[model samples]
Target: MTEAINDWMAGFEARIADLQRKSADLQQNIAASGATATSPDGGVRVTVGPTGALQDLQLAPSTTRYPPAELAGIIMRVAAEAQREAAHRVAQAFAPVAEGTDAMRMLQEFLPPPPEHVSDAPVDGLPGVDDIDEPPQPSTPPPSPPPPAAPPRPPRRPSTQDDDDFEQPW
Candidate 1:
């Protein structure tokens, strides 16, 4: 019975370790993945990290031709594009962990797809795939047989001898 419990525990721990490794891999991929987008005329550029936070921005001297409001609009649009692209990369990064699971479906439903044109910037390319992957679930071991009941001792026998080892009533 003890052996059985040990075997079950070992297998459960191995599965847990595998799950942790998968989570780490997914996090590393997400950190490494990001996207950048630029306006068509190259007047505006925006870079976003895996989480869609703006990491960098660049404006060309030619952008001065546009009114301040117009340039702001252009910048906003390009930033949004970069954010969308970053979301796509993040989704890809989650693939190893979430693919074909309900969590992946939720991610696909929430994370926006990358822009149609990769030529917008010099950023890395993203596949047309949608959705991420699954989340981890802990497994429990089957119940083990209860420990065997302790053996019973024989009943005490009455002493028949009047030796020093025996106690006698007065």
Candidate 2:
């Protein structure tokens, strides 16, 4: 009986190992395919690697007017948003490999909770931590453009010949 039990445990351990290896591979794939997030209003943009490291930032000209404190706050918020997006994307990209298993749960261990909701819904059904969804599509179609207009030219006026050419210093 003891020998039989050992054999069963060994098989279980091997199965777990196989699952773990597959999970690691899925993670590597996700890391290779990265994600980025940017402020729609063009205020800020940030990119994060799959490992959640800060990769890059681009700031709009308008942000230059902000004081250091305010700028820092905006940067922090933007970075957080970017990171959240990256995490969500990673989870999503790996979903195919992660579904119906514990892999997705393991992936969540790497991500910090969102500021408002602490649930792990993003990767709940995937094999890895889910990547954030891409921002929603714009609702309305672009407005029909008006016909192009000619550029305006400055108004011209005739000069009077009797106008004084010189003025007194006093």
The best candidate in terms of TM-score: 1
In candidate 2, what residue range of length 10 has the lowest lDDT sum?
Answer: 120-129
Model 1 lDDT per residue over 1-170, tens place: 99999999999999999999999998898998888998877789999888889999999997776667667877887898888888878889898888999988898899865545433221122211121132233457779999999999999999897677545664
Query: Which candidate has the top score in lDDT?
Result: 1
Instruction: Work out the TM-score per prediction.
Output: 0.59, 0.46
- lDDT per residue, candidate 2, 14-98, as tens digits? 9999888878887777776455665534667788887568888888896665567656765676677777777877877687676
Pairs that collide, model 1: 97-134, 98-133, 98-134, 99-133, 99-134
Off by over 4 Å in 2: 1-29, 109-170
What lDDT is reached at residue 137 by model 1?
35
- Please state the error at residue 37 of candidate 1 in Å: 1.2
Each candidate's number of clashing pairs is 5, 14
Candidate 1 to native Cα RMSD, angstroms? 32.9
lDDT for model 2: 0.67
